[model samples]
Target: MKKIRYVFYMPVWRKGQWKDNFIGYGIAIWTFALNCWKPKMWKYIRKHFFSHVEMWFPDEDGKFITMTPEIDLEPFAINSVPQFTGQCFSSTMRDAQGVRFALASEVLRNPRRWWYIEATVTDTRYELMLLLAKRQEGKPYDKWGLFTGFFMLAPYLQNDDERYCSDVCAWLAWMANILPKRLWIISPRRFAWLLVKNLNRELKPLVKGKYNGKIQKHSRISRCVQIR
Candidate 1:
């Protein structure tokens, strides 16, 4: 079992042409999914410039692993399901520029300009265990939650039948007491910003240095969260 030290990966893209862009347009699609087609969400997406976010952890063998929900393409249907994948360092650009294998430590250095935040969750092993065990196959994607969330109509629309990337992360955060049970929920962008912001306020800065090259360990930050 892993101790649940986590890192987040966020991709950024440079502009050129439609076909040339992946991260940029990818964000558009994801943000639309997150916000339920809310026109105002575009402003927030543009403001943050983040398209996708994935959770990472170090395995027993010290290899970095990623857990995120992805669209499962089928013959006539598609769905989103949680998947465990290997570490990939690429911009998803036209040519997959700057792709490489990066360790959890090197992510903070951000050679590709990705964002990273670290925190230790109490009993993360148990949380991850529960997540894996409780995962049900054919769990429908919460596509309707998008519309409900966008219109601010009914928060009850989010069902237990499906799993979304941020929804799963947010649920774990709540279980760990890092977040509270309340009216407003969190999206991937919001969860990323909130968790990092909260940890920065509570923990001491452990490492800071100048930007070097790719795969270089730039900064290492640590903080402990008291799970209630």
Candidate 2:
């Protein structure tokens, strides 16, 4: 089996685009409000541009498989379940753009700074992640956890049946011994920061001028889709 690596999907906002949106405004407000007490947190918020993250593994067929939580309100859970059965580096959903496997590493091509991690994962660790994903399949998305995480100022909010995007990601990492602790009530952005800080100390920014040879070589998603 191909070694599994974690892929962090950043939100792609055009230049000068975020300044006009609610997300931009909200981030700004939070930065201003918590910068003093949470300087590290503020720095993390400022550094990350992408809004989402997911796990990827190479399947038995040699094709890469991606797993992430999809928001589903009807059953009030992360309904897509494992989200494990698809082409690697492909788009998560049909309508979304800039989300394909091609773009997974493609974001690094841009001039703006982005974060991506590639670690040599063991077969046991990979299977652990799969088991955790199986348990979380069809779980509810924890909207309240998202709110209370911030409100209560604790990531470890009440653990119930539901889970939000970051909550599940954080949980899986903790369970698999990837993340050090249960960083309860976390956001995707914060989770990204924590992963880099806690796990990989050698993490570096993807600068504009540098050639992306590492990604091209390591990101052997599949032969059917040429990376270039």
**In terms of TM-score, which candidate is strongest?**
2
The total number of steric clashes, by the backbone 3 Å criterion, in model 2 comes to: 13
Against the reference, the lDDT scores of all candidates come to 0.44, 0.49
Q: After superposition, how far is residue 77 of candidate 2 from its true place, in Å?
A: 48
RMSD of 1: 14.1
Candidate 1 local distance difference test against the native? 0.44
Task: List residue ranges in candidate 1 displaced over 4 A.
Answer: 1-47, 61-113, 124-138, 182-184, 201-228
* Top-scoring candidate (lDDT): 2
* Candidate 1 structure quality by residue, lDDT tens digits, 1-228: 333433333454545655535544554465547655556445444455454343454454543433333333566544332222323222122232222234444444342434445555655654553454245323544555533555565467676565444565556556666566532445655665566555663211212344333331123221121111
Please give me the total number of clashing residue pairs in predicted model 1: 0
Clash statistics: count for each candidate:
0, 13
The root-mean-square deviation over C-alpha atoms between each candidate and the true structure, in angstroms, is: 14.1, 12.5
Per-residue lDDT of candidate 2, residues 42-141 (tens digit): 6666655544455554556644334344555887876322222322232222223322233333323332334445455566876787676766665555
Lowest summed-lDDT stretch of 10 residues in model 1?
219-228
